[model samples]
Target: MNDVLHPSLLLFLGAAVVPLLRGRLQQAWMLLLPAAVIVAVFSLSQGTAGSMTLFGVDLLLMRIDALSLVFAYIFAIITMIGALFALQVKDSTQHVAALAYAGSALGVVFAGDLITLYVFWELMVFSSVWLIWCRRNPTSMAAGFRYLIVHALGGVVLLAGIILNVLDTGSVAFDKISPESAGFYLILIGFMVNAAVPPLHAWLTDAYPEATVTGAIFLSALTTKTAVYTLMRGFPGTELLVGFGVVMALYGVTYAVLANDMRRLLAYHIVSQVGYMVAGVGMGTIMALNGSAAHAFTHILYKALLFMGAGAVIHMTGRSKLTDLGGLYRYMPATLLLYLIGSLSISAFPLTSGFVSKTMVLEAAALDQRALVWLLLSLVSVGTFISTVLKIPWFAFFGRDSGLKPQEVPWNMLLAMGIAAFLCLYIGVAPGWLYSVMPEPVEYNAYTPGHVLWELQLLLFAGVAFFMLLKFVGGERKITLDTDWLYRWLLPRVVTVAHRVLQRLWGGLLSGLMARLRWLVETVNRHHGPQGILARTWPTGSMVLWVAVMLAASLLVYYF
Candidate 1:
């Protein structure tokens, strides 16, 4: 094998063949593929850009630049963590699908051309949908179909944009194309859909929770972050994304506050978290971009850790709703500890990975004097404080005990969560390890006294708010609105109303035409049918006389 076949490709393609084997052998391959990819990507990062051409278009199959490196590195780490968490799953198909899905994301990150990015993008859709359906339940099947439709629309937009971009420029290089053209807007909207930016984000909540416990962990880490990577690479500095990101941030928090399903709540928070990343990219400063990339790295770790903890709980107890779960600390202490770490990290506690990374973006926003954006970020942080850190662990693990006793998770699952947990705390205390891999050289500090004090006050006040309004916050109702409602409800109603108006106008025109036809038929019947001049019995005599005259005229003409 040549080195040109990028190591990420080797892992992805290798995983698809694993299902051909039987039993435990297949499981072994499943675990090994992602781990191998992690090692492969890390090693590949040390080299220069390696280009490959197919279909007469240059594809940057392996770009080792700093921006791509940050995303690719974290993707590999999350893949290993996900694979570890999924080790106990009996289904080889889910394992292969998750690995392929993660591998496809790596391919996109490394891709140097729009065509290459798109190829991997579509592959990502196909590979991840299988994970959603891994549960083999009717609900999952429906959710997967919806998920497919949303992503397929996104794919179409991306492909159309690429084609137009290539046609316009005579090259498909993956540089930031202008967002003025139809193609660029189409591509931006497409990327936003996957990024779960408000309005089109329902698929995350509807589909992710339906995946098998093992599959959801992998699903949570890849697709949205890939969209974030694309936005960073292509649409950074687009002013519209700042507003869009703010909307997603608030939208996610609102729905998450009302969500009952444990995983679904986390999925909503995913949208919220991505909003921060998107806004940072929109800021267009080196610090902001670095913050976005760094956050993506940390988000993948802690988010995957959170999902793994949720998956372990679901795996042991066969439950996922907060109302139906509580006091798991009595039965699964390891999982509780891991879940708390993920929660604290996600909440941006001063000494966790989230704090180290997320603050950079918010700090960047403040320094840039984007007062509105900074305010929105503050509100989102406070909201995160309410919905996730307080809401998730409190309800799922420490709420009223549902009196359910389930065994602790398998050793591999615990080990995976432990790895993620350790990293979260380790990075919280020392962010230098993550800062070093940023696309640009890092000069900012994460733990300044002022920054720490501000975050502490925000989080503490939010916690107080949650307790003061505890009676109003806890409920079983689901918030029924999102950006998806445009297509799901508003668009359909608009179409239906247009159809009704067109139907009425057409019906009136048809009625008038039919009436005229009826009148003409009646007139013809009176004039030319049995009762009309042409159809009456007297017409026979007139016809005979006319025929005689014609014959005479014809005979005279022939003689002449």
Candidate 2:
């Protein structure tokens, strides 16, 4: 097992080669690397490899267990899918950024210690930002900057926690960190930020919508999902995460319902869906943890499918807003069909991947008597259906015709989405294959008659409500600001006001000081000028007489 080629290394190496080759060779390299990673991940066993001591501390590079294997497997799978989606993309930089982003995420998953994890954690931020910026526009550039800043801050907090925790415990093992630890909150906030928990989640919605289509595919799958993997690894069962998780679920749906941008709506849903996994980690039951792992795996599949579908629309129509799109089903029949499969799967419809995974968390909540948690989470499913299943299709493809005649997406895009759609269905039909790879043994059945009945009723009623309230829920043309308003809107105005106030005060102070300096200089010039009385020329004899008079006055004063 130690002799097995490292999957992360394969991707990083592949990324380097992406620029050197051209045309078909580069494309071949892209698919081949992830293919190799798939083989490497499946070949992994439960062991630590690449162990070493640095500065008198032991470090583990590779920690292969059930949990790590699960993430690594999906990451490898998505990388290949994303590469295929981008096969028609001519930008070599995107291919490199995506590969490196994937590599770093895999590194985080397989990391055996906090040090290794932190290193890869930062790499994920730096490498992935390029995907957003590669769109090479003002909006994307700004979004990329914000994305980089937020994730970097998260990484810093995480690093601070790691340093403090290591000093307190004298070890850097990346395991279940306790709440009582000095660095616990810092570490939790750091993870929550990346997990797209609210107040810290603006970056994802802001940048992801603006990312390049192909890059968004990788973006949707990797960053936050890796954060979820870390939470599953390091902070399982921490009570606060339950609160954060539930908030994320509600917050995402609220903003999503208000969204006009197709990708932005999907981004908010990322917050919501990841919320399920976060809550499961907080529950910390074997069933809950298994649910979280399974959900993370399926989420990558369906979420990527959704983003790819949305991306294909943007690619074909050169438009992404719901207000700008309509009646596209006929032109892009294959796109609409594939997109609906992902939509249905994400909504947790019976016989979908979400049906199997999302229920485990709710069932765990019920078992633990967290009725409020279960109820709120169940309600979130209604919103999921309204936003993803009902709202997106109603506005974008099946609603009134927007009069834009666009062609279908290219074959590569369809093939890539086709692969993801197939997996979403496959996992749904046979949940056991997914459950078997869970961090723990999963015993829950998602297809109980009562369970299936409940899901249908929830979705059916939600669909009905969406149509009933259709007048108000239609996409608005105005900008929808999230917590990002603090920076994008409020903070800049604050800076502007401060700058103006300082400028006025400095201007007045400088003007007054200059006037005083001019007065003082004029006084000196009046006395010192050649035309002045003191400046008049005096004879040498008069100066000598004054000196003698001064000497006599000194002698008289001394005698007195």
Candidate 3:
């Protein structure tokens, strides 16, 4: 009944009960819990709660500021939506894992200190990987392990940074950090890994496609966005991030074009879309930071919706490869329609959620006079349209028929997608509703005549380009090598080679050792063998003569 309760606490407690209940009651409880959290989140006032000192340092379990509240709100909304999408799932473990993952993400958002943040930060990794592993397939399991290793390393890096920062500052306050401080870049890399920045981002595209149909919805929403929240909090205005952000945006677009798996392609777009957020954090202006937060919110919605549509296809057809998918629009017209809304939203088409949100970052860029940043981001938008809007839709749903004839997904899935789809359109049509939640005041206008005109032109051009390069853009039935190849292919090969070398070296040393031992045995045998002089029947005569000589010498010496 406490109004000051942490949303994460509620979710964690709810996750424990999911396995205990059954049937309709269990489903009802699952939906009710996140619904309640959403209400509670919106009801919260700006302040900290659950304050106490741990090991001589004060901690706030719930810090309800504008920024944290922004993330918390969207997180709660997506948890409910994800739960709804997963309502038909029979696996209680998956439900528990999904809820726990969402809770941990909320925990990260509201955490008022590095220690509290870390506790939830790690919990997010442990809880979310199950979504992948729960699929109970070899590919999913392998990808899950890789996901674990990458995040585990990232967590170690972040923890080291926290330890160094704490030692240097004698405090664990999670506030705006100075870049000159000791743990700055380490913490940034830690956050960057979560944000799915390039080189460190392959885990996303690698694992997300392998998750359960419903579980992919949550995966697409939480992990990387939470990293963006942290980056915005910890390292805003670190100009180095501008370059990193640009690379992430382009990197995602590039690989997404190569992706044959529909979900994997969308996963790459996650990295691309989050790039705007990372750049916004780097810009550090109020407008820019708000853009980052706004984009995270909108991204979670549209991205989750997109995943829902993709998952519905995968669930029904038992296939995910774009090369294998076609003429799906004829059978799954409704799903295609819903998915296009998401596709258009992601492309920042006019009057969509992406339009209202993504442009804020671009506006921030232009205002900052970062001409190259603006230009590159604009190009990423073009690529976004080409992939998600033009390429994916055409190839996956309308290209050459692969003889698929699946029906529409379940009512719950449709309802979930419907809700997200509606929201995407609604937010686009009414930008004020989303803008009002800005951590800072909203100043940039998304629907300006010039802005809308320019965006339309860019997308129009991208559409033209896609058709021109249609042959080149269709999904191929092949695996596109990524950074994951380092571990998946190269590392194992390297280990195998090293093992062989070590074995040969060990064999040579053992051979030399045996040879030396053999020679020593031969020398010892020669000294004591029956044919040797020392081994001959010596004797009594020699001994007697020697004894007589020794006695005579002793007698002479004594006389002298």
Candidate 4:
């Protein structure tokens, strides 16, 4: 390994040259960059690769540990897949933004200091927003702005926490810390915001569906997963995450059930799936932490696969709402088949990646004797099957035919989805391949007979319930509200009303002051007008006589 050359630097520098290339050359360049980074990642030894000191503060530019390596490997692989999916896009700007976003995520994964992490964190924020804006529509534009605002706020919170932590400890190292101080709590808030934990999560659902088709693939794979990586690294063992994670798990399912847009439905599932990882991090046991990391790895692949499948549908039909799509399977069987693979994986069916990864977290909770946590997670798994597996595929592919005949998406898109689908299956069948790369040793088996039977029963019952309530759970052409209402609607209205009241008060004060000044001017004019004593305009001679009289009086007084 070249000690001085960081893998992230390779992608970032490569992004700079992307706009300069054209056609086949650009496509080749994009593919080569991620492949080269994969090589760089494999060649490096497990330690800090690039280190430096600035102003007496130690900075680790590249930290190659088991955890970071796992994330870096998946991130590089997804970047390559996203590039492949986007090969048909003629816009260089989207390509550049996607590459830079990938690079920033890699930077965050490997950063060994608070400052370095923050720099990459902000870069991720800036670079990813462009992917949303690249759609060049009003909805995308507005969504991109909202995305930037939310992340910018998260960045501020993170910076404050970093500053306070550095001041308190006099060290800038990025390591695990207990949430015993104001700084760590603030830091957790920052991480949660990025993780899209419930109320702070609307930005994700708002922006991702609005992004360009190809851009949505990258958006789905990176941002929140990076935050998952950070939380697993920094705040593992905080009990608060357990509760929040459960709520997020259930909350996402509820919204996804109500989601009308296909992409939006998938967007909500990201929250649901990430909730498992967050809960595992909170559990803080070796198995749980390893579960979180492993879940992140599997989630990135499967979720991107899901997004790619959805993107292909939208690309072919120019419609993403479930109401507008139906009987697509007849036309795009390959896409439908590919999408079902993702759906099964996310639903944690037996012999899928989700089963392999998500069970670790649940088993940890069960071992810890958190009955409520275990129950809630179990229920959420059923909801996941209902919404993602049953609702999404049934409505989009097999529901009432909309009489729209659309061809399959381009080959590159199918190729990307194919690769992800294969991985999801491979990981499920050969869990050891994934478990071997985990941060800790793996002793748990996902394919135990008891576990498989229990999961099958849960999924089977959920499938039955979904069919029974299909009418009620059917997609409605209505928008459901979330915590985002506070900022998106309520807060803006409050600010506008406050502005009106303040404007009226200011106007009244100005009017009163003007009226008083007018009255004073009138009084002055009344006393000093042409008819008044001072304004009688005494001649120069009269003025001189008054001066002489005063002088004579002065002299008489002096004589006396």
| Cand. 2 TM to true fold | 0.95
Ranking by lDDT: 3, 2, 4, 1
Clashes of 2: 0
lDDT tens readout by residue for model 1, 1-560: 12545756676678869778777787677667777777777876444466767778776766668888888888888888888888777787887788789889988888888887899999999999999898999989988998999899888988888888788778888878777554788788888888988777888887898998988888888999999999999988988888888888888888888888888888988999999999988887888999899899889888998898888989999998888888888889999888888988888899999998899888889889999898988888888878777887787777788899999999999999999999999999999989998988888988889989999999998899898987677648454566667766899899999999999999999999999999999998889887678775656888899999999999999999
Clash totals, every prediction = 3, 0, 0, 0
- Please write out the lDDT profile of model 3 over residues 1-560, one tens digit for every residue: 22487888889999999999999999999899999999988999987788888778988788888999889989999998999999999899999999999999999999999999999999999999999999999989999999999999999999999988888788898998777679988888889889888889989999999999999999999999999999998988989888899899999999889988999999999999999999999999998999999999999999999999999999899999898888899888888899999999999999899999999999999999999999999999998888888787898889898898898898999999999999999999998978888899898778889999999999998888789888999888798898999999999999999999999999999999999999998887787787766688977999999999999999999999
Q: On a 0 to 1 TM-score scale, where does candidate 1 land against the true structure?
A: 0.89
Best by lDDT: 3
Task: For each candidate in turn, give its C-alpha RMSD to the true structure in angstroms.
Answer: 3.4, 2.3, 2.1, 1.6
Q: Give a tens-digit lDDT track for model 4, residues 39-128.
A: 877676687767888888888888889999899989988998999999999999999899999999999999999899999999999999
lDDT of 1 at 399: 76
Candidate 3 local distance difference test against the native: 0.92
> Cα lDDT for residue 212, model 3?
95
Cα deviation at 147, candidate 1, in Å, is 1.7
Worst 10 residues of 1 by lDDT: 1-10
Q: Can you write out model 2's per-residue Cα lDDT over 510-548, one digit (the tens) per residue? A: 999999999988887788776666788999999999999
**Comparison by TM-score, 2 against 4, better one:** 4
- Candidate 1 colliding pairs: 199-483, 199-484, 527-532
